[model samples]
Target: MDFFELVNRRESVRGYLDKPVEREKIEKIIEAGRVAPSACNAQPWKFVVVNDKAIVSQVARKLYDPLISGINKFALTSPVFIVVVAESRNLASKMGKLVKKKDYTNIDIGGACENICLAATELGLGTCIMGWFKEKGIKNILSIPSNKEVTLVISLGYYEDKEPRKKVRKDIKEIMSYNNY
Candidate 1:
């Protein structure tokens, strides 16, 4: 698909079909993230692909809080979950962060997450990037070390048939500027 079309098609899908996503396609999606650029080429990111049904359910449980009860309920139905973990910055990136006073690792991980979502769209799969979950629960369930940060959880699967919604965004003129702001 054309890049623009793929970008337009990429939406936060909330509904999925009862079908399994192929492992090969999952690998391709992860490969897209693996190749994403990072600060000082640190590439400080780890992807934990969860496909086992039991574990998927356990992870899904962590998405809900008592008050809301079932936020991100779509997670329960998605066939796969890719947990994006942010690792510590490398020496160069750390020094750069100190000098620049910026967290480049997060910027890099955001790009990697976008790559995964775009790759999934290109491969005809639906994905939703979720951040409002119980981070501690997810880390414990995944056996992730305390040193790593749980940045995002992506639910992936084939989408249910539905009419596409019009894309809504700020006008280019409103969001962009020339040499002068």
Candidate 2:
């Protein structure tokens, strides 16, 4: 499918089948994430692919209520879980001067996560982005260093149920403005 079609078809899947995602497809998704643009080319991101059932369950246990209810459910069904982490860089401490003030790592990692989601949709797989877990618990379970922050957790597998209805959004004319607001 083309880009527009993929974008429209790509829904946040919350239910998944028992089938496992192939290693080749996972590699492609990771590759897509790696190629995403980053601020200043820092690319300060790491992706942890969790396929083991025990670890997946442990990570799922960290999820809280309401906000992550669907994700918590998806975690139990999807065969693969991908955790996106952003490494913190102390530019001032390293270079003796401050440079960019924004959290570039978070921005870069978010782009990478988007790439993976789009690629998964293109490859006919289902994915759900999750971010309502307890960070300390996830860090302990994954053995991630203190310097790295968990940005998102994605559940991946073949879809089992129909996609949810798309949430309504304002039209371009309604939201967009002319040269001046």
Q: Measure candidate 1: CA RMSD.
A: 1.3
lDDT of 1 by residue, 41-126 (tens): 99999999999989988998887565686689878888899999988878998998889999987789899999999999999899
Index of the highest-TM-score prediction: 1
TM-score of candidate 2 against the unseen true structure: 0.85
Instruction: State in Å the error of residue 121, model 2.
Output: 0.5
- Quote each prediction's TM-score: 0.95, 0.85
Error of 1 at 74 (Å): 1.3
Alpha carbon lDDT of each predicted model: 0.90, 0.80
- Tell me the lDDT of candidate 2: 0.80
